[model samples]
Target: MAFSSGDSGGSMADINVTPLIDVLLVLLIIFIVTAPAMTMRVPIDLPQKSVNPPPPSNDPPPPIRLRVDANGQVFVNNNPVATRQVEANLLNLLPPAMQDGQAVEPADQPTLELDIDRDASYETLTTVLAAAKNIGMEKVAFLDNM
Candidate 1:
């Protein structure tokens, strides 16, 4: 067999991947050495579970729906009631319903649900809330349209 360089030639030009493999091995070793130091150590205290049952419902009576229109008119239980008479009306109605004679239990107290029109002012809503508060009603909820 005879080998020629120029006119009578055979191709021997090919890229060897041995150098690439060596480089990748070196990078992998470097990452393994530095990986532990680069990570942030965190101490976590996870919560434990308990088999205790929840306390019984101390929920108030059925909610009284109060609607306030754009004109600042207040409605108690769907019936229109004057703004000035709101506190008075609530005071009169709530006590009797909750009280059996003199003693009124905490569980018997009714919740208040306020449904105000989009055009209604915040002042009117607050006033209605104030009335409920004055009448000793604690649980109050605002009605929103989905």
Candidate 2:
């Protein structure tokens, strides 16, 4: 039993907020701990922007086929052409970006696949290679068959 001595006896009017404050603070800490887990983030660095261009495509552009036959005949894509015309013809096949007598990145240029006939004269191969090299064609490779 409780009694008041005031003129008008009344119950307590001020609320005790200590427990409320404690509950609120605990809930806030729980949310802070669980918020990162909710996002399901894996520890990694995602680029904010495109730092480097996308990796080069797996598929490469078609290669130019330069075939030399045993008869010393020079062929550009299976079409016979004169030895003197080989350099001009190969340069014609080049993309516009490679003709400036400047260095071009290997990835930006087309490839030259030399398919020299097994019995083809070595002199013909040398002549064709020289012509290609003269015009700054550096992505040349040899074909094993034909």
Candidate 3:
């Protein structure tokens, strides 16, 4: 903060770092204030159930199979279905007790077997997953190498 008198024959060439430090501190404060906002919670349709399914039944309904290929096409038991129809398809596959828009208990929840192709887009997978959750399917497993 020292200001040399102008009477000196040569001008001072030293860099003033006080102002630079002040500017940097201000920027640091601003970023810290905005950091939490960046991580604010968003309401997403996602399931919270664990992968462990309930005990086996005498003859449990067959698991629903979903296949997603590179082109983002979704197939249920080899039948092609649009991404938007997945929720409805899941509802149709469930039994009467689990199909009335009420949250299904884990024992009554159906298992979804996902066979994702090697080249499928991440978006396609997420979309299919969201549809399942929106319909409240809790048991899901990802098939490997297909």
Candidate 4:
């Protein structure tokens, strides 16, 4: 570092950059050393790809059919069920294992196929939907009669 002796009558304008360049070179070397370590491969046990497709299991049980007539009549598998008893009827359609309040997996659950008439009132549709939902029925498919 050069300092004005006071006789020069002006401040020194030269910057001391030797220390800055040394620090930058040290940081550059540090980054270069760590870059290769960061790129080191981590051995992950990924699943092997299989060429053959998995064997198909037996067909799932038939879905429970629910039909609603224009007169607001709800039917469980063709059996007439009052609007209030819709939940009970649907519950009865489940397997014996599920009727005991055991935790049933979604795959093991019976699917409800709703065949609603076009002339059915919105109230009837919503009521039936609410009943199905209250029974914790996860799979409900709507049948298009067109």
Highest TM-score model number? 3
TM-score to true structure, per model: 0.52, 0.57, 0.62, 0.57
* Overall lDDT per candidate, in order of appearance: 0.73, 0.80, 0.83, 0.82
Candidate 1 vs candidate 2: the lDDT winner is: 2
- Provide the global lDDT of candidate 2 against the true structure: 0.80
Model 3 agreement with the true structure over 1-146: per-residue lDDT tens digits: 44676788565667989999999999999999999999988576456666885576666777888899889999998999998888888789887777888875666566899999889999888888888877778778889972
Candidate 4 least-lDDT 10 residues: 41-50
All models, RMSD in angstroms: 15.9, 22.2, 4.9, 16.1
Model 3 local distance difference test score: 0.83
Clashes counted in candidate 3 amount to 0
* Candidate 3 off by > 4 Å: 1-54
- Candidate 1: tens digits of C-alpha lDDT, residues 1-146: 23447875685566677889999999999999999998967443333565964443576456678889989899888889988888877766675754233444434666677888999888887778777756666557678954
> So what's the TM-score on candidate 3?
0.62
Q: Ten residues in a row with the worst lDDT in model 2?
A: 41-50
What is the clash count for each candidate, in the order shown? 0, 0, 0, 0
Q: Give the per-residue lDDT of model 2 (tens digit) for 83-127.
A: 888999988887676766777665666788998889989888888
Any residue pairs clashing in model 3, and if so which? none
Off by over 4 Å in 1: 1-60, 97-106
